[model samples]
Target chain A: MAVVSGSAEQTVAHTPSTPATPGAPGQTIAIEVVNLVKRYPKATTNAVDGVSFSVPQGEIFGLLGPNGAGKTTTIGILTTFVRQTSGEARIMGIDVAADPMSAKQRIAVVPQQSNLDRSLKVREVLTFHAAYHGIPRAERNARADALLDELGLGDRKRDRINRYSGGMAQRLMIARALMHSPDVLFLDEPTNNLDPQSRLFLWERIQGLNARGLTILLTTHDMIEADQLCQRIAIMDHGKILALDTPAGLKTLIPGGVSLELRVRHAREQPADGASPLLAALRALHGVSKVDETGSDEQDTSGEVTFYRLFAPDAGALIGPATQAVLAQGAELRDLHLARPSLEDVFIYLTGRNLR
Target chain B: MATTTSPTASNLADVAQSTPPTLSLIGGAPRPKHSRLGLILIAFLAIFRRDLAVTAREFIAFLIQVLVQPLFLLFIFGKVLPEIGAAQAGFGAILLPGVVALTVVLTAMQGVTLPLVLDLGFGREIDDRLLAPLPVALVAVEKVLFAAIRGLVAGAVIFPLAWWILGSDYTVRTDRIGMLIGIMVLTALAGAALGLTIGVLIKPEQIGLMFSLIMTPLLFTGCTYYPWASLGSIKWFQILTLFNPLTYGSEGLRYAMTPPQHATVYGHTVTFAISTLATQWIYLGLGGTVVAFFILGVWLFSRRVVS
Candidate 1:
């Protein structure tokens, strides 16, 4: 285990349901951020507000958020790419704000965009990056060559990167980031627009890196990818984390860990707020957490086909009683479904304003 | 062409004094703390190497842009006019020094500014360099220093070309070669400082307008084709030219290279030594300008990198 630094992370508002390693004694934090706030000049609101999290060594952490969430801004601050308006960030316990130069030495970021130098050949690109890290000549050469081979870029070493495909460019960016052998790696949307082959290869590479003791923090909109790759994931919305948990743990966050959907005939004209005995009975059942009648726009005038989404555990066991309750209220059941919620469902449950 | 091994121009930059590394680390592999300065030096050299690789790839295009205009200016007014019996031969003597000054300044300024603008603009390539372990301010410093070195090289290479073009008309004294070299160094740094300022501040879309609005005005008023004293007919313009750093560069080169003697054209003697700005004033003008613009460029650069 790497030597954990001195600063204790602040208490999180939404702690991961499956607690993080909290880094055992003497185990290090690869990345730490606390109460970070940033407002771009002339902007009305903060881009990142009171964001805090820490990843222990050798763990893969995911920050899952929609487009405008503060994932990128938080990563940017920790990587020394953006200056924050307030609060603290430490990379490997080295204060990023106080001495970004030292912090940069231990961290690497593969940015969302392709920022490759178009003018240089592939081999020179990595070597140049290594040189900037103060790696001596012979070692830089060996590392560049070895990284190129491992990333499948050896064949393209002599060619300029202007002609590279999106996948090749992304692979090159990853290779370049690894040239310095940083203790922590941050990948922002690492597989956003990639083909299946490229995505799979990158996933293996990411797992491979973590297996070798490189702590990684990545941001991605792909719920499945985040679910599969990260040991712990944080769901964020509007610059604040709403929930953080393991994939299964996050799945457990939605009211009773499952959803029950039913389409029923209201038998009379019904408005959104107007409810019946069926809803009351369903809510009163054991293990049922919520009964919502969030139907579609096609609700009829005289008689409506209303949709009820019931939150409960072991929804499969609730079918007979739920249906009997519906019929007793003079409503006819049209369609029914019992589901085990995935991370996507949990995400929609926690973050989505319409659902929340 | 393999800049990976070729120290080339960047080695020249290492000759300049560098600041101490501001990094202090803990719980990592034991760094050679005493040699943090060496690490900073290596990073500076890496930037220089990258610049060399990029510049070398388009070196021919760069040389053409730096040389053609000034050469044409010298050829038409200095050589063709004299050969065709249209103007005085002494005009070539007056123009040769200014042309060298123009080449050094143009080469250095464009060398720094164009790459910088492209990187900071749509390229976003500056991100890689900003990620380098050296202090962010030193990245800006290394670029300015490297550009100055390129300017000095361009100035040196231009003399041989100018000598070949003007032939017998290329009359210069070696006695003040030391002062001439000093002026070239200062001119290159001053021009590079200006380049750094423009590169960081200007948008890529505004680059064309930059040449027109800022560069064109600077070129015309910099006294590259005529002596500073000759602007006496336009006293307002003369004082205005004083504000342009290029004016000092051109005037200093003319003073160092052109003899104190006179040349006759239609029985009128054109005296150059008395018709130029003094070495003290030229040195002061360029030295102060370099320092001022360098500070401004670094501040602007640090802000741009941080945010």
Candidate 2:
């Protein structure tokens, strides 16, 4: 469980300190969720079980996992839309369950689905949301107009939400969530069903928001999205976080930091030995960490080719030595490639399965 | 994308030095401008205004739904019966208050309850409203209040229509205008409260069952067609109908709109109780039902929506 002292602005609602005022960059915690658990009625297991993490101010934090992995439930608990079965969540240092109104005042949620009111025009959604946060009429209008322009929805301000496409509706949700200028923005799978073009557009917008110092907690099953956007990620599965680190740091958890693969043809037939001499020669190379052989009996009509995988801490430096060692063993190398471990490799390494 | 300076960011920074940039950039900035209560009131009005706008846009459908049943009832009891000599000349006057009462209760119930069920069920549009920074129970009350106001409007539409269509068969005495207004207000409130309670309690699939089992019985036994005093001959029905909140609403409107002598005059025909005592009891019953159901609705609604 991560615990932090409540900020003065949060403790005192009417204080001069506002939620949006920038604190010293890393000193304040935007969201602190402690040992959170949420179990539905008659359900045998908790949807989110003993999950704990903290998102620092101005960071793009991610909860990455497959579907039904409790990512949405955790977001729901943090945003005060759903209560936790047990444990605590604090938004901007205010306890979510004990004082949900204060917690709500400090955060906004863009849920997985488009929860916008279809009856209202695009601008009305933002205006009404601002009004709910107690913004005056003129200020709300200005904010609504500004937000619509910011989100690239200015031309469609008068359009009803029912007419909006999936991507447009999602942008509207984000615009609406931003209307109150919440300190912490919870986006649960914001780009789940978007086309590639819209998804890239949203990614840029999200990066801009984070650059402006918004504390963003987003959930996604897309490893590439998490790697590209999140400053730090908690890889979760089965309602528990399996790993937590930066994308690069997580990739290091693989047995070998990089994998080097070589397809070779023997220069001459070798005398029978317990193990292939080429494997032993590659393992003896200076920078090589581990060696793996893929046995393939079938070969092209011209010659028999064997594949060898060499694990190395620094595959770039070992390339010359590895190729030389293969040549000294009288093997002709057909192809050679160095592959750095990716986030997907890290996920598979940790979970023993690919992210669905 | 073009870079534009955030207006809220600058204004919020001026108001509070410690305000986070995220807050200022996303929303203008939070200041000590409004008290906690004031903020709550603003949120309440925001939600109320949203519902009002939606109801206004669908005003034609609302009018048709609210007016149809009452119009048919008035046409039958007030127009057809008297013309065909199947009922007394003044019978339309006796049924007039009941028609208004029925309209208020049914309209209010349907206005609030059906939408609530839909909001909580398939639509889930209520989730957006629930996200507002107010107590969950207060939001539930706002729904009831909005529905109550709509109920009053339904009554307004029905009253003149009932009078005009019922023709000379009915006469509404304005001697106790204050009492008449008070009764109408109380009836609207009671109707809204009841609707809220039922809306929160029933499953979406049970909406049809609610009309068949609960609404149909309440309407028939609510004295919409005749006086409660006239039900004395059927002793079991009088006892059974005390459970229906609409009965008190209809009776209260009957006492307020009809001539006072009619109570005793009608009493002679059915062995009715003292007029003043009956009227006071109806008032207390309506008020009590409103308070009870309002509290229950808030509690249940908050529990359901929040969880």
True contacts kept of each: 0.40, 0.42
CAPRI docking class of candidate 1: incorrect
Task: Name the best candidate (by TM-score).
Answer: 2
Clashing pairs in 2: A20-B19, A20-B20, A20-B21, A20-B23, A21-B19, A21-B20, A22-B19, A22-B20, A22-B21, A181-B27
Alpha-carbon shift of residue B139 in model 1 (angstroms): 0.5
Residue pairs with backbone overlap in model 1: A16-A244
Give lDDT tens digits, candidate 1, residues A20-87: 44344455667777888988899888989888877777677899988888889889899887899998
TM-score of chain A of 1: 0.75
Runs in model 1 deviating more than 4 A are A1-18, A22-26, A260-311, A314-338, A353-356, B1-34, B263-274
Which candidate achieves the best DockQ against the true structure?
2
lDDT of 2 by residue, A1-356 (tens): 01122343333222122222223334666777778999999999889998887766666788998898999889988877789999989877788898888777778888788878776778888888888888788878887787788788999888878899889999999988888877788898989999999998888778667656577899999988888777778889889988877776777788788788898887666456638888888899887778888756857665567888888778778789888988998778888998878788888888899998
Q: Model 2's A-chain: what TM-score? A: 0.86
